[model samples]
Target: MIKIVSFVMLIVVMLQGFTLESDYNRAHQKAMQSDKIFIIFLTEKECVACNKELMKIMNAKNVSSLIEKNAIFVVVYKEQKNTFPIEMLYTTQYPTLFFLDKNELFSCKALRGNIQPKELMNCLKLR
Candidate 1:
């Protein structure tokens, strides 16, 4: 009985974690409707660092909470068909974090490379 209960609890907890939208247009529209910033995470398929950084964000309670409260988080893979404006966010690197305001403008400087949890929270708070 205890094992069954624990498994159920674990499933619930995992389901409560932050979710990233893969559709740029839907995410952007939701962000505008919610009056929150849009956070775009650019990653590649074979990037170990990007996966590590994504794990950090997912594991960090503070970062995840802040993002959930104030931003629309979207993950766009390099090889995927996405609607992200390449001119605005041209990057030669993986794991880039771009924050855009409710008006669909750049909120602050883009963050590149691996970012710690606290650093992600700080960056999100800046906008």
Candidate 2:
């Protein structure tokens, strides 16, 4: 029982590690240190369909081999606008993917709205 409990907890933490960061500064710092592109995913709190589509992409097979390794990611909701930098606080849609490098912070706006998993994977390759 003890071994089983420990295994389950380990699995939970490992899964959580793959999820996008909720803090912009931390993700940006990570990007700088790891030489990874920084991507900010913006969504409104009530956007269900958009969130599902994003989940499909993030939870796709070979996830750890792709986006997780290539980018330092953060997700920002409309309600959390005050938490991010003023320049990063704006978005044109309910869901948007903003890709930025350390040299050019918050400058690149990628996708808007629900995106397919294949599309996101393709975009990842170009970055």
- Write down the TM-score for model 2: 0.72
Q: How far is candidate 1 from the true structure (C-alpha RMSD, Å)?
A: 6.4
Give the residue spans of candidate 1 off by over 4 A: 1-16
After aligning candidate 1 to the native by TM-score, how far in Å is the CA of 91 from where it should be?
0.5
Q: What is each predicted model's overall lDDT from 0 to 1? A: 0.75, 0.66
The 10-residue segment with the lowest total lDDT in model 2: 5-14
Clashes of each: 0, 0
Largest TM-score belongs to which candidate? Answer: 1
For lDDT, the strongest prediction is 1
Candidate 2 residue lDDT tens string, 1-72: 534633553454357455467777788888889888777777776576666655655557664357677877
